[model samples]
Target: SLPAAAIHRGAPGPSVPESPGAAAAAGSLFRPLSAEDGEQRPAEIESLCMNCFRNGVTRLLLTRIPFFKEIIVSSFACDSCSWSNTEIQSAGRIQEQGVRYTLAITSRQDMNREVVKTDCATARIPELDFEIPAFTQKGVLTTIEGIIDRAVAGLEQDQPIRRVTDEEVASKIDEFIGKLKQLKEVHSPFTFIIDDPSGNSFVENPHAPQKDDALVVTHYRRTPQQAAMLGLEVMGSCCSVVSPLHVLQFNTNCPECNAPANTNMKLVQIPHFKEVIIMATNCDSCGHRTNEVKSGGAIEPQGTRITLQITDPSDMTRDILKSETCSVEIPELEFELGMGALGGKFTTLEGLLKDIRDLVERNPFTLGDSSTPGKTEKLQEFIGKLNEIIEGKTKAHFIMDDPAGNSYLQNVYAPEEDPELKVERYERTFEQNEDLGLNDMKTEGYESEGASGR
Candidate 1:
């Protein structure tokens, strides 16, 4: 599979939104190229064509998409056989996480949107129940229509042979091909998905710098198998892997009963964004088990405040990555989980709420002479309200304020706006910086400072 390409270099160009209204939404981002822009020649290299064993030329264009990163698009053509090929390669390094792009195709205009399918990317049409496996046909830089056309061509190519040998299978193939062809007309809406472990695939959005209702993009941590595919994971010594992904175990005392225990500490990468160290301890004497998550990176420069409105029970299933320095707040329930209350956690929204209830009930201050009947009743009422939110019986806003900017709250409705979610990033206040001990930290000129002060 050598990471080959499927885009035909002979394509005049990608289909663009032609309707005036669609063009308006596209703005300068998707505007047609001017003569001056077309005058610029791309870099070229002459090479042997694998098809005809004749000399061919490959042209490379380096361009940056609006509201997106830079990329290189290469087109190759062999004059002898008139064979053409096109490929797209990401100019940036491998991202921290793999990405999944889901696009809802409901109209002809939608089919014109450009797509980048890397060699390691898998494309699927859920409505058709058909999938294009990675490296099956090579990477491609084409439009939604282009991908479907390619599928149609591949299916029809095998029908002739099937009709001669296996008429039964051939008839089924013909029927399936007919259904795939109808999709081109978009008689019914269908989902187009591209899951790329390399995080190199892309689906264009005419409405750039704004949310697209029909598209959703989610970032996910790569599994060991996926990492191995990308050459990021290797066998041999456990230490062969990079930091924040290694396992370390040591002896420790159990917190529950002060008994001897062995704590398993593994610094692992989390799906939300970064790496976190997870510690689990077991006490054989008391049969006690406990696990905890701890931050493994330095404090972020800016602070993050994420607000998610819980309007549906399904929202409870949303993933939440709460860093050690984050605080959870529910104004409607008049409840707040202060910083360091639950330490660091990677769990679902409902799970976090449940933990909050348990932590409050177990608060040492809730016991002794300080605990009054009135206080107990109030606490019980609050817990009940928390349960309602978790059950989606009541609507509420879940807020996480992290001065370290490492926390994350999943948006089930992504690549599009989730009316229920709003996020804001702000500079940390002086007091907040002091609390995180960032004021005393020196990141820049440390060598010079050491030389001078020492």
Candidate 2:
């Protein structure tokens, strides 16, 4: 199945509260139900069932206590309507080496209608399981031999009385059946279901009858193992195929679990937005983290910009690169703030503006030196003074990388600084890399030959 890459590509409507005059008048749409009243059941109804069995000793246990009756209830609501229909059963008065049972059925209509019941006083509820074939289309069982052959294939080879593999295969068949269920075909409204009557088929584990009327209906009163196999068939198949809604519950195969787990990846495609963060990652155990980066000037959809940033030469390249690369991908653009990059190469305002205008003609953005006349030389003097305070001289060491990947320098610093006030000193550290690409070199703080060649 395709991932939800373009789910949010469209613009959304604005949110505003409606006036009180637009509110609807309060009133009940349907009549409320009373304990004694009976009415027509809704199109769909929720149903519940209970069954019980007892041994000789269990019968004796039941006779001694007035309220020691065992009761079990399983409930389900209809898909089309919220009506609740229930089937209740009780193990009646017990006789030595004999069993008695009673069933009470009712729908949401308050009508105490008993749909079906059988008092199996002589028949002992036995454990059983069975398997049946499923088809994508309704009324496809034209040949009896073919249906029997499929049912046989669903059965276990070793155990003839109980089914095993057939259940799993049947599920695969159900996957295709579900797709048909959505179609406007004759079988579209049907669902595959397991129909268990006695509820004693699987010892502690019971098999409930499925309500799907899409395929050929065959009742197999076998052992619980047989019924279990039948269940496996429908489950395996229906689960394999999914709709848009069901995909959310589906898990991707995660290597750690050897099972499918959902992914955090999302696709964003929009022209105006250069980048968008589809998802974020953080180390739950530790504070270390990273983010995704978009390259090739790709903009995210819906004009959403992500965490990716363009590199500026003037900023601390080490910090920026380390922060950006620590997570997923590197950003596309870079900015230079050193001696000669963008419009910042010239010291004068007019010269800087001219450089900027030229840059605007080629690119949409640029950076330039912002120093004014009074502070032009003062800034230089401040750098020198800081160097002397830290190193006891006007000069300090420096290291830089070349923009063209052709040159590099280490341990070079200013040779002059003010020799007066105490200077706060801090060490600079560079990141270690085995192989630095052209983009990586830019972060190493290197200038091009045009600016530093002299």
Candidate 3:
């Protein structure tokens, strides 16, 4: 039997206003839940067993959260299967924008601060190269120490770390874990970042900061890519059509032909890099096909450059994911791949060369009666050189310059000992950032060379 005041079936109730303190707190904000009868309700429903198909009773408790607003806490238990589950949902309207919280943990006191993380939040400790992606765990009301412990647990179960056979690498990981545990008691400084595209996460901010200091909270509009990843409506005329498995499809005109073409875009999450939207387009009328890759995350503060040499045939198999803002260059051949020249693509070095070869073969500058003998000879020579590189008959350098830091080159089994393959990363210039849309062109910023303070 439930309380009569607690059960409200289908009626309009008075709206409960939020408190000032609740609105100021850097935690979850929610409005009170009321039914048409002016009373809150706790609904009960059937819960199906995940392992076995047995059904059990699920009780949903709707109540006002202490110091917050209202939330629904649901619990379920199966007597036959001995299974249990619990979940929480905020009784508030969805926020229009996402939030990013950055806290610099300098003292043990900072480690004990409360943290409220939603299921849509992604936590990252950049100093340790550790990350917990969205939906890794349910929303949790825990302290900073608890978050670190969860990260440690996730790292222990990581398949890639477990697959590493190098004794030194394994020892390094163990040392990192030990250091993370020590941060709870020790005063080691580190940065803790939580990004939530759903705008449902929060960090307990008891006292408001007066000056620019450690704990910095910033709210940013979700990029089109990030919005798509979170299954939110994009802010544009393009209507997103939901397909199977959360894929988004939309209609677009083919660049080669005027016919209508269907573009399929999906969000791809990479380990080290940020989320990316992979779009594949095809036109049946003109046989035009194109694949484009765009970063679905924030613009990186710094840029990245990857340089690799193709010495053997096996090097051609190395994977490369180039973002639309990235440019490719082969210094040895005096060939440069400008931005948007071939569009963004995810392919092997061999496949990329093949694509370039095909582009050269199809270019009007190389073929047709308008071409001269010298131009034709030069094009043929370049094609021959590309073929040589593909066949491992000659060596060539592959350079990728990405100001957005979204491009990636496989480095798991890379020959770091070889001097031929050089990889370097440096800060991008203000102009470069402006060109990449990272900063406004009119904004004033300090100019720098290869490495200098901004």
Candidate 4:
């Protein structure tokens, strides 16, 4: 069947055929016609719907878009299944590079600015550590606030799973939703970023006398990875996997035993936070296995500190999601767990202590004959302390200091009036921010003081 654009529309009856030269000129105009010429030669074509396998109708309307010169607006509807689809395609030739749009949403008015996002565009809110990868949703023409609202809906849809597994994470997701809503109210400041590898997305730029300081537009060549992800590397080929989230497997040599291994990497979405890549590697030759978690999104703004008291056996069951940036401390034992100590993990307090114990046991000095008596005694003492805590035979302080505020400790069941269990959130100091390579973070107008201890 002919496409809707192929069907001709003119003066009510059967249309008179134009000369071959005129048809060739019309085809040329579709590539690069000036706004004036496009307006002078408006075209509309309609045909039976091919989509829905129904005899309904479809229309192709060629019009001059405001900023964009010429575009084809296609619409289709089928009464049989009530199926409908609408898409806009640029008539201009495709560009060789991609475009990126960054808008600083500082006021409520900014939220109302028009935004055009293609299906191949990835949207990000760095401050919120939230991102919507390409192919996650269909192309849309909406406002900044509308995009944020859609993201909120997506996060909300995943709340049930988070609530059952980790209520702390669930509560954090709620906080993030509130922050997004606050942006709609102009109560907070955030940056909105959109990268379209197809160079088809756009953000409205109202030409005002005073240029808007809030908007930044840039164009650049797509990286090889971006090109491959968008299926642009091959001219006429499409990606085998259309979804942005998928498992990837690769072969590698194990770090521990230097044996051949296979690694499976999966993208995991954490409610309220950025997506994470969870990688698990197994060496069949030596039965060696390892796992790691890496963030797939942006770094957090402020820092977080969670302090909990291990007073009873029930406290050992509390879940914790510790980010790689977090530093765990047990002041009672004079022990500290830095980044890469246990890698990033989601485990209970008891499980965390057990992991620490295992690491201590693996230390060369712990089992070496050349080890000094004092060193061995200290290691044994730390192990005994961990065991005591896990057995609920002793009470101790558990502290987690994360400069990115990505780590979490469950506190859903904490007593409201208890002074022992606490969660403290603070602004990252200059040194801390520098250490995290977040020197350009916008901290102006944000509270410099630490949040009152909870």
Worst 10 residues of 4 by lDDT: 8-17
For candidate 1, the per-residue lDDT at 174 reads 90
Stronger candidate by lDDT (1 vs 3): 1
**How does residue 33 of candidate 2 score in lDDT?**
24
Better of 2 and 3 by TM-score: 3
Which number leads on TM-score?
Answer: 1
Q: Which digits, one per residue and each the tens of the lDDT, describe model 4 over residues 293-326?
A: 6665666667888899888888898777787778
Each prediction's Cα lDDT score? Answer: 0.72, 0.23, 0.66, 0.66
lDDT of predicted model 4: 0.66
* Best candidate according to lDDT: 1
Residue-level lDDT of model 2, residues 255-349, one tens digit each, is 21122234343333323212222322343322323233223222111111112121222211211111111111111111112211230021222
RMSD of each: 22.5, 31.9, 25.7, 26.9
Residue 453 in candidate 1 has what lDDT? 100
Q: TM-score per candidate, in order?
A: 0.46, 0.12, 0.42, 0.41
In model 3, pairs of residues that clash are: 11-36, 12-36
Query: lDDT per residue, candidate 3, 1-454, as tens digits?
Result: 1122222221222222247464335122222343443553345678787757799777666554332234555666677887766565655434545777888888787886666677778998888787888887876656788788877776676536554766677677778888888777756688899998776666644232112267665555577888888777765674753332577778986654345789989887765556778889898756878887777777677788888877788888877788767778887777766554466788888888898787656443244233458757776787788899999999888899887778887764544444555666789887676455556434443455424752
Better of 1 and 4 by TM-score: 1
Better of 2 and 3 by lDDT: 3
Give the range where candidate 1 is weakest over 10 consecutive residues by summed lDDT. Answer: 1-10
- For model 3, the stretches where C-alpha displacement exceeds 4 angstroms are 1-245, 414-421, 441-454
The global Cα lDDT (0 to 1) of model 3 is 0.66
